[model samples]
Target: MKNTVCLIAAASFLCSCGGITERPIGVIYTNAADPIAATASGGSRTGTAEATSYLGLVAVGDSSIEAAKKNGGITSVSSVDTHRKNILGVVTTYTTTVKGN
Candidate 1:
């Protein structure tokens, strides 16, 4: 029973809720952007769609490529990027950026 209890506790603390490929560096704050896609065309226009999460409970927003394109008036997509920010896991925001002409 003691071993089982210890295992459960360890499991709970070891589990994480994230899609990051590598270990996260920021426990208190994190704001970074990563390139996702690229094309041959030179992008002259830019648009961004964002989403936010509160205490990992309520998440709202449209962080989609289509939304970004619509917001930027972009007909041809040349590049795509993703931006993420987390403040002590209490408030988190994600943004999808699309660039096109």
Candidate 2:
């Protein structure tokens, strides 16, 4: 019985030490043109689409965000304009880990 308890405790300690916490990645931004100007500015439309794509991949109000903040990660917030006259904003945070050579 004692041996089993000792083994369990050791395993728990090892698991705790081996855990890796989730971290933030980065923020993204995009800008689009007004309906009348979109036709004139292809670049703006593209930028707006790019920003939308990036925002789609972000997870907001997740526990990971809190964890990253607690771990000293960098946070960024941005705004994007869409071709449809819509504006979107998002905030992202990132945590970095360095592997030894």
Q: Pick the candidate with the highest TM-score.
A: 1
| Candidate that scores best on lDDT | 1
Q: In candidate 1, residue 80 scores what lDDT? A: 98
> Model 1: residues >4 Å from true position, as ranges?
1-25
Error of 1 at 29 (Å): 1.9
lDDT by residue for model 2 (1-101), tens: 99999999887654523344332121223232322111222221111111122244764332233333333332331222223112233433222221111
Where does the lowest 10-residue lDDT sum fall in candidate 2?
A: 42-51
- Model 1, 28-89: lDDT tens per residue? 68888888999888888999999999998999999999999999999999999998899988
What candidate 2 gets wrong by more than 4 Å, as runs, is: 16-101
